[model samples]
Target: MATSRRVSRVAELIKREVSQMLLHDIKDDRVGAGMVSVTDVDVSGDLQHAKVFVSIYGTDEARAETMAGLKSATGYVRSELGQRVRLRRTPEIVFQEDRSIERGNRVISLINQLNQNRQIDDAVAIEEVDEFDDE
Candidate 1:
């Protein structure tokens, strides 16, 4: 078992290395079809497994291809980590598609739409009050 600090450090390190791999090392054309970013990494307290959350920006087909490419490259990524990192044993890597960013954007758009509607309602109410005052 590893301390929480050590686990977090390892997770950060993994995230950085994975990002580097995506930028320059990964050669899969499918992965290149989308804009891939490592959103976060979750390391088990035991430090034996890691979940890598990634956000891919593209059309649905492109995202699907990118995910497939990532899944196939998992073994290579693990081997690279084992060689580059000084862990006693390399943690197993699992890639997960993160949709939180997309969801957050959708929520923000909805809020903005609601705010615009509220402003319009307020303006109409003010106009009605002015007419009532004149009568």
Candidate 2:
């Protein structure tokens, strides 16, 4: 089993290399159809597999297409990793779509909306109290 530190380091390296490839090396039209960014990477303890999390900004169809493109290019990405990183055995790559960022943004928006509504309700309550007090 690889140490946690080593695994994390390898994960980061893979994330960086994959991000570079997406930015410059990858030429798949489907992938280029959407704006994709590498969000995170997870490597197994044995360093035999890696999951690449990507956040794509676009419609659902575009996102799906981008994922398919990434999946199709996995072999190329893995081969590139073998050349860029000096590992005894290059890990198998798995592309996963990450929607955490979108979920987080949605949660934040809901929180803000609730806060705004609460403020408005508070103001109305204060006005009612003032009217009763004036009676």
> Which structure among the candidates has the greatest TM-score?
1
lDDT of 2 by residue, 3-85 (tens): 99999999999999999999999999999988999999999999999999999999999999999999999999999999999
Q: How many clashing pairs per prediction, in order? A: 0, 0
**TM-scores of the models, in the given order?**
0.98, 0.98
Displacement of the residue 6 alpha carbon in candidate 1, Å: 0.4
Stretches of candidate 2 off by over 4 Å are: none
| Residue pair clashes in candidate 1 | none
What do the candidate models score in CA lDDT, each in turn?
Answer: 0.97, 0.98
Q: Which regions in candidate 1 have their CA more than 4 angstroms from the true location? A: none
| lDDT: worst 10-residue window of model 2 | 26-35
Relative to the true structure, candidate 2 reaches a TM of: 0.98
